[model samples]
Target: MKKQNIYILAIESSCDDTSAAVMCNDTTLSNVVATQKIHEEYGGVVPELASRAHQQNIVPVIHQALTKAKIDKNQLSAIAFTRGPGLMGSLLVGTSFAKSLALGLGIPLIEVNHMQAHILAHFIREEGFDRPDFPFLALTISGGHTQIVLVRNYFDMEILGETLDDAVGEAFDKTAKIIGLPYPGGPLVDKLALKGNPQAYPFPKPKVKGLNFSFSGLKTSILYFIQRETAANPNFIEQNREDICASIQYTIVEILMDKLKKAVKQTGIKRVAIGGGVSANSGIRIALKNTESQLGWTTYIPKFEYCTDNAAMIGIVGYLKFREGKFTDQSVTAKARYIIP
Candidate 1:
C-alpha cells in the first residue's frame, strides 16, 4: 500500500512573534512569522501587547501559511500549537485558535511544548541540514530558556542542566541594554561582535556548579562595568561598542561551551545539537563548529529561520505526534509552564 500524505497546520504565539506554518509530514511547505515591533520601544516584550497582537495576526498568518503551501484547510490532518513554557496570554491565544480550528475542520489537535519544538526543529526536512540521531545532546538557548537536554527518542528527552536565574539569551540582551543598545538587542550584539575583538574586555563567567548555568551575576557585572566606565568617559560605549559586544559574546559562548563539554564527558555522547534563538549567535556557532574539529564532536545546528520562535518547529513536532496517533481532546488547554515529560 502506498503511504498517505499528512498535512499539519502549526501555530506559535509563545512570545512577541505570531507565526503559522503548514507542514507536509516532516517537510515545511510554508512558514509565516509576524514579529511584533511594538515591543522594540519597551526594550522587551510586554505580555499584554504580545497577546493582543497574536489575536490580530493569528488568522491572517495561518491563512498566509496555508495559501503559501497551496493547501486547503480541509486537507489538514491535524492542528498543532505551542501549549506552554511561555507567556500565559500568548499561549492562550494560540491554544484557543488551534482548538477552534481543529474543531471546525474535524481534525485532531496536537499540543507542542515550545522548548521541545526548538529541539525537534532539527527534524524538519531541509536541504543541507542533517538530522541528529537519537541519544544526542541538545543545547536549547533562547530568550526565556537555557537548557542542556538528553534526547533518546522523538518524545523521550531529559533535561541534564538548565539556568538557575536568567537564560543565556536574556544575559545577552541585558548586557546590550547596559551598553545602551536597543530592545531585542541580542542579534545586534552578535552583529557588532563579529567586527570586534573577543579578548578586548574580559568579563567574568559565573561560578555555577554541576551542569546547570547562571547568567544573573554576569549581567549585573556588565552593568556595573559599563556604569563605571561611562562615569569617567560618557562616550565609552560609543568608543568601544564593537569590542564590548565581542567580549560579552565570547564570555557567554564560553559559559555555554563549558557546560556542553561537561555534559559530553558525563554522558559520553559526542553528537551535539543546538536550537532556539540564541543558537543563531555567530560566536556560539563558531564555538560549536570548533568543537567538531578540536573535540571530535559532531554538532547539529538548524537554519537561521528555525532558530527563533517559529511555527515550522511546531509543525515538525505535530507531524511526529500525528504519526503515533497522539492527539488531544477539547478538554486540553494552554499551559504557561509546561515542561517536557
Candidate 2:
C-alpha cells in the first residue's frame, strides 16, 4: 500500500511575530511572518500591541500560507500551534485560531512547545541540510530564552543549563540601546561589529558554574563602562560605536562558547546545533564554525530564516506530533511559562 501524505497547518504567535506555515509530510511549503513594527517607538515589544497585531495578521497570514502552498484547508490532517513559553496574549491569538480552525475543518489539534519547536526545526527536510541525530547538544538562544539542551529524542530533551537573568539577545539589544542604537538593534550591532576591533573594549564575563549563564553582569559592565567614559567625554560613544559593538559582541560570544565547550566536554556529544534568534548572529556563527574545525565537533546551524521565530519550526514539530498521534483537546490553552519536558 502506498503511504498517505499528511498536511499540517501550523501557527506561531509566540511574541511579536504572527506567523503561519503549511507543511506536507515534514516539508514546509510556505511560511509567512507578519512582524509588528509598532514596538519600534517603544524600544521594546509592548505585550498588548503585539497581541493586537497578531489578531489582525493571523487570518491573512494563514490564508497566504495555504495559498502559497497551493493546499486547501480541507486537506489539512491536523492543525498545530505554539501552545506556550511565550507572552500569554500572543499565544492566545494563535491557540484560539488553531483550535477554531481545527474544529471547523474537523481535524485534530497538536500543541507544540515553542522551545521544542526551535530544537526540532533541524528535523525539517531540506536538501543539502542534514538533521542532527538524537542525543545532540542544542543551544537555543533568543531575546527571551538562553538554554543548553540535551536532545535525547524528538520529545525527550533535557535542559542542562539556561540563563539566570537576561538572554544573549536581550544583552545585545540592551547594549545597543545603551550606545544609542534603535530598537531591535541586536542585528545592527552584529553588522557594525564586523568592521571594528573585537578586543578594543573588554567586558567582564560572568563566572557562572556549570553550563548556566548570567548576562546581567555583562550588561551592567557595558552600561557602567559607557556611563564612565561618556561622563569624561560626551562623544565617547560617538567616537567608538563600532568598536563598542565589536567588543560587546565578542564578550557575549566568548561567554556562550565557554559554556558550549563545557557542555561538549561533559556530555561527550560532539554534534552541536543551535536555534532561536540569537543563533543568527554572525559572530556566533563564525565561532561555531571555528569550533567545528578546532574542536573536532560537528556543528549544525540552521538557515537565517529558521534561526528566528517562524512557523516552519512549529510546522516541523507539528508533523512529528502528527506522526505520533499526539493530539490535544480544546481544553488546551495558552501558557506563558511552559517548560520543555
Candidate 3:
C-alpha cells in the first residue's frame, strides 16, 4: 500500500494581518502574510476596518501560499484557521473562508486557538534549532497578552501567571504614544533604546504576587512622569527621547524577567521558551540568552518571522492535531475569547 501524504492549508486572521500557509506533513512549504497598513493611521486597530481588510486580502494571500507551495486547492487534506482570542470581525473573515473552503473540498476543518499556536511555533522544524522539551515554561507576550504558561505536552498547558490589566506590548505602545510617537511605535522605541541609557529614567515596577505580572501601574507611572517632566521643560521629551525609550524598555524587560525567574523556581523547569510578538524585542532576546549563561538554563526563541502572528504556527498545530484525528465540524465558529485548556 502506498503511504498517503497530508497537505494542510492554514489561515490566520486573528487581528490585523491576513495570512495563509501551506504545510505538508510537519514542514511548512509556504507562508504568506498581508499586513493591514490601514491600522497605522488610526494609532491602533479599528476592529471593523480590520475585518474589511481581511476580507480583501484573504483570497490573494491563500492563492499566493498555494502557488508558492506548488499545491492546488484539491491537494489539501484539511483546512485550519485561528478560532481566536482576537477581534470578532477579523476572526470571522478567516473562519468563514476556511469553513467554505473545507466544505467545497470535502476535507476536514481544524480550529486552532491563537495562543496555543504561538506556543507551538517553537516546534516547527528548523536546522540547528531544537524544540523545547515537554514541561517547559513559555513566556507568551504580545500586544494583547502577557502570560507564563507551563507546557507538559502538545495542547496541554497551564497558565502559571498572566497580566492583570494591560499587556506588556500595550505598555510599550502606550508609552510610545505618550511620547508623541505614531502607531506601531513599540519597534521604534526598541530601536531608539539601543542608543540610550537604560537607567536614565527609573520607572516603578509592579509588585504583583506569585508568578503573575502587571504593567498597568507602570503605564500609569510613565504617563504621569512624562506629564510632570514636560510641564517643567516642554523640550524634555524631545531632548531625552532616546534615554526615555531605553528606560521604558529596560523596566519592561526587568518585570518580565523577574516573573519568569519566579516561574522557573516554582516549576523547577530550567528549559524556557518565549513566543508572541513582544518576544521579537531585542532586549528580551538578550535577557533570555543571559539567563542561559548565568542560571545554567536552556532557552528556546523562535525566528523573527514566527514570533509574530502567522499561519505557519497555526499550520504546525494543525498537522499535529491531524495525526490524532482531531478535526472540527462545520459548526465551529470564530471565538473572540478562547482560552487554552
Off by over 4 Å in 2: none
lDDT of 3 by residue, 1-341 (tens): 98788899999999999999999987889989999998899999999999999999999999999999999999999999999989999999999999999999999999999999999999988777789989999999999999999999997899989999999889999999999999898999999999999999999998999888889899899999999999999999999999999999999999999999988888899999999999989999999999899999999998778999999999999999999999999999999999985
- The clash count of every prediction, one per candidate, is 0, 0, 0
Q: How well does candidate 3 score on lDDT at residue 182? A: 94
Per-residue error for 203 in candidate 3, Å, reads 0.6
Candidate 2, residue 53: how far the Cα is off, in Å: 0.6
lDDT of 3 at 125: 83
Candidate 3 to truth, TM: 0.99
Off by over 4 Å in 3: 1-3
lDDT of candidate 2 over 6-39, digit per residue (tens)? 9999999999999999999889899999999999
Give all TM-scores, in the order shown: 0.99, 0.99, 0.99
Best-to-worst ranking by lDDT: 1, 2, 3
Candidate 2, position 320, lDDT: 92
